[model samples]
Target: MVTNIAKAILSVLLAAVVSGCALGISEIPVAELEKRYASNPPLYIDVDGLQVHYREEGKDNDHTLVMLHGILASLHNWEVWSRELAGRYRVISLDLPGHGLTGPANFEYNTENYIQFINSFASRLGLEKFTLVGNSLGGYFAWNYAIRYPQQVEKLVLIDTAGFPLKKIPFPVRAFTAPLLGEISMHFTPRIASSILLREVYAEPSRISEAMTERYYELQLRPGNRRASQTLFKRNLEILRQEPSGLEQLTMPTLLMWGEQDHWIPADPHLKRWQQALPHAKVVIYPDAGHMPMEEIPVRSARNLHQFLSGAEITDTSE
Candidate 1:
């Protein structure tokens, strides 16, 4: 009887283990992801031994605009903006190392390394001077790149950019930074979690489509992408701890585009900080948008950018 009871207990435990294993999310192969995600055959360039994935449109135009996406975001974030602005100005967008199709490389994922990657990428493409635009973490890189290569950056546009001290990281992102929890959390990325994150970033959660959420979830499962995010998140925390130094010194034409509904990084305080630092910079605040105004309100945001580039007077549209 004792032996039979022991066997029954073991069987129950084994069944529970199998059920847990079935629930775990598997990593999506890069090739399969490329098939589903890549709208075109995707272009890549050799930058610092990394085959950087990039897209260039409106190559014939005189002015070049290089755009970058935020953490866990790919160049696809700029699809609407790229299409809208490409006709007017040459638009180039790329998947920075460890994000999108460009998976993890040997280089350390830090601010300096990211800045160098931007410089090297621009040089490899024979781009001498271009307007640099970035969103979220990409904004951090954009401004830093402009500071390091001020002469090379003709103009700088920061869309809900980072680098200013964050009072608190949004919970979804902060969860991925905890030591043990981060590693475990990476393996169980659910589709709904992606949807939740997308909702958090958009002012109107109702606007988030099924396809958009699916894409984010699929890309997060790209092999090694989660691990890279973990590393990047830790590095970013380090960045937030240090004081931001060179905003006032950036004397080039600067444009600050913010979303009034940005909960991840409140628009009011950050906007105040930026305005104080860049008194002469033009500011455009989208009232009904969230963290990513480019994705949320592409038409209006792009129009503001076009106006700024054309040297037209920007009527304050915050109201």
Candidate 2:
């Protein structure tokens, strides 16, 4: 019943309405995060035009332990350990560039980009040297950073890290890394997506909880986070091709914790490579754990980490 001009105008208005609603809903402020739940307030530092978000807990005199979360994960991933370790150590957890409340990096998201972020973050905090613990992508960054700046890292811990190439990629990874398909697929991620991700990450699916799934979903919806995740996924493929030889050069005391049931990076050959490269490294594989051993077996993992950092009686099985 409407004229062509009226229809065109109506169509434009409708499109704008939808777009506006989408953006408005997606734009979640960093400050509002606390209102939703009890979380450590974010400490911000200016770096390359971006306000980096980090949390520091415990006394300043205790040994510093810097924890890095995996890809698509924020500092909240270390909440359990941060609380447990705060009594004995100065625990610091940061949301890497392009993730969590940190926003996006000014430069490309890659290993070198992360290296700069870590160094900058450390310098800003006046951290001369500290123990580094990283998981998954964080582990890769930790290994790279430690290799380049051995003196800056007192000890290193890698959990289900990605450094070497694999013959077969996991289903989720394969789907996430695909071209146009991946972009389209991200919008369709449901509440079940977190469960699927957790299932793949943990050897025991029973370990996953509704609360964990809810946290992941809530964080993913943070302003600009999903786009940044996509950017990271795309850039990581290029970074993986470089094959940094720094692993063989590491001399610091290292701990490798992995889940025996990790589908992403199988424990067999990858662990062997780490063992061979890091002759001084101690390795522990949790039989019931999956890709994220720390979350799956926090007690045992934390004990091992505490012992390693304290220079207790540790066994290096590879030797």
Candidate 2's residue-wise lDDT over 1-319, tens digit each?
A: 1134333533544465556533133455656654553344537888767787878888565589998998777887787787778888999888888777776678887778889889888888888899999998899999989988889999899998888776565554555666644554445444555666777777777777888887776677667777778778777775554555857778888999988888777888788878888888988888778888777777667777787888786532321
In order of listing, the candidates' clash counts read 0, 0
Off by over 4 Å in 2: 1-31, 314-319
Write down the TM-score for model 1: 0.91
Error (Å) of candidate 2 at residue 227 is: 1.5
Per-residue lDDT of 101-146 in model 1, one digit per residue for the tens?
Answer: 8888668889899999999999999999999999999999999999
Candidate 1, residue 34: the lDDT equals 84
TM-score, cand. 2 vs. native: 0.85
C-alpha lDDT values of all predictions: 0.84, 0.75
In terms of lDDT, the poorest run of 10 residues in model 1 is: 1-10
Model 1 alpha-carbon miss at residue 306, Å = 0.4
User: Relative to the unseen true structure, what is the C-alpha lDDT of residue 100 in candidate 2, on a scale of 0 to 100?
Assistant: 76
